[model samples]
Target: MHLPPKQGAAFDPLSEAFARDPYPAYAALRATAQPVYYAPFDIWLLSRYADVQAAALNPLSLRSLDHLMSADEMAEERRAQNWHDMPFHARFVQFSMLNADGEVHQRLRKLVFREFTPGQIERLKTGVATYVGGLFDRLGGPFDFIEDLAAHVPGLAIGRFLGVPDEDCPQLRGWSDDIVQYFDIDRTDARKALAERTTKTFYDYLTDLSKHRRRHPKDDLISRLIARWDTGELSEDEYISTCMLILMAGHGSTIDALGNGLTALLRFPDQRLMLSADRTLMPTAIQEMFRYDAPLPFFHRYASEDMEINGWELPKSTKIGLLYGSANRDPEAFADADTFDITRTPNRHLAFAAGPHFCLGNHLARLNMEAVFSQLLDRYPRIEPVTEPVFKPGLSLRGPKSLPIAVR
Candidate 1:
């Protein structure tokens, strides 16, 4: 398959070189008929800021996830390779708000939104504090930040949300890693099979936890979901899928953000120092980090009808991947778009996508990030990188796989 030029070459998403450093290629794309088309992937790449924003704004024209495909798109993209795969588990993404559209999307989102009420999120700070406290005590110099710290933040946070005990949070992290590979780059039959099995195990565990909660409800997300299910707003299938969605999407990107954001902070000591001097800048600093190194670079969408983007005509049902990563760094969107600046105002980065499919967990994710960075900056006067970071490959969600650093 054609891939982004390895090293400092053309933009190819499938190459390890691009995965390590994609910005140069993305920049090259920005300087051309970008996001126009990729012969290998057989999908349009929407890299321009306006086009990516347009896709997210017009979800009706460009869909997210399965929304199940309306039977027509499914028949068309059976390989599911074109952004509408359903082979793993029927309706696997069925109840997921990420995969729904219109009324169904609204309904699913409302159910979730209510559960994440402002009051509920505020109360979440206690658990977050506790997890961060424990994690900080054990972190020290000469450590793999991605594995030792960044990876655990989301796991512990989600564990508290899912009511998994502290001890089991580590195991849950493992299950999360194995199962989330369903969205990984280049899935072999072996990888797919392993992911399915891992997912089933994770799903079954949650199902049992859900059943137990039904018998004796608690103040956890699963219980809240069960409560909604009992009220007839959610089906058992929806209940299961929604729980999985929260467990996966909820924590996954935050972990990635922490890795990507912190790496950028370390690489740009000036910006990191600026944020340290003025804690109020934390919020904006995080925003800049997102724009600088978007956790996930692109979002997937299937063309709902014939449409034109940046002068390119896209036929109905065509697969499209919106390049938010590139857009965040587009010169037209941000002055010195490639530079890492925490003080950047009006930083409208598409790290979290936008419109109806705008990240539902944005508030929680921001809170978690702020909390983690606060602890890190406070504890370590210097977060020194011992080695170069490595990235996990995918057109979507991108982050460092390993970031070894020295904390002092």
Candidate 2:
């Protein structure tokens, strides 16, 4: 019996050093290859902007919705861990768009698109502004912006969009936190237990909400999804899956962007001040922040067929990890890439991804960030970081877990 060679120092993608600051390691990794580099953990890392972008768009090369994890693997690693039970896993398996492909992905996306259109998102701006204003008005002295501010807004806004009750906002936030924690490799049994409990509770609540929407449809996204289900355009499983995806993805990514974007600004004060002084810079600044400190750093894909990319041969069924975070910082793509410049021109970042699966909530995420930052600067111009921003323990979603700041 032979074991895989002990993970090499030259390629530990999940190393503590790399996690703390992955830019330097990514740069080193990118220097070695164009499309593929054999990294520790038996992972194939895609780092260059062109390669990452290409891989994301090329569905024939990289399929997003394959069974990346085996049944035995899920049972032993995920289930035996006693984190969550069969029903919880079943719900996620049935409905998550991340696990769907081809016709299913397209149909589900179309249904979701009808509900989350630009007009609906535009109407959400005032509500988001009002929510941010109220939250910021209550803040004084020092606070953890991630906890006190960034995390709350998206969950609240998403709740409103989905017609989730006001009292359930905190519960939804708690569940979202737990679901995210399940993705953390370093997560403890306790965290898993908590997440499992939250998963059951959340699903029960959503089930009840689904029932309610069935009886009394309203002008909410949930109602629209229910309408589709009634017309036989969407299956019951699809409805459940789409709703869960919208609730979790819609809120989680935006929360990360808000927290991560603010942390980036704090790390570079000059850039922060530039945006603070000139309100007009908010839009470009938001794009730069996304490019500079992407919340969802990497996306996973399975190679659908044997292919050659950038001169390297890849076998079919290879698990490819597209390093969007690294690509955004690639010097070959962006001049002076490592520097956090709010004024970066022609910033074609793959933060929201690209191609057929480009994030449907891109506009909403941008709008929410712009609204929050613009309101924060307008009311309290003296916002500054008071402590180091603590990042979450997962490479998948990169953002601060807590950001302490002083705001006048």
Q: What is the C-alpha RMSD of each candidate to the true structure, in Å?
A: 3.8, 3.6
User: TM-score for all predictions?
Assistant: 0.91, 0.89
State in Å the error of residue 317, model 1.
0.7
Tens-place lDDT per residue, model 1, 51-137, is 788877875554653553666755666465523343334345334677777887788888888656657667778778777878878
TM-score of 1: 0.91
| Prediction 2 global C-alpha lDDT | 0.75
Runs off by more than 4 Å, candidate 2? 1-9, 13-15, 33-35, 62-85, 93-95, 184-196
RMSD of 2: 3.6
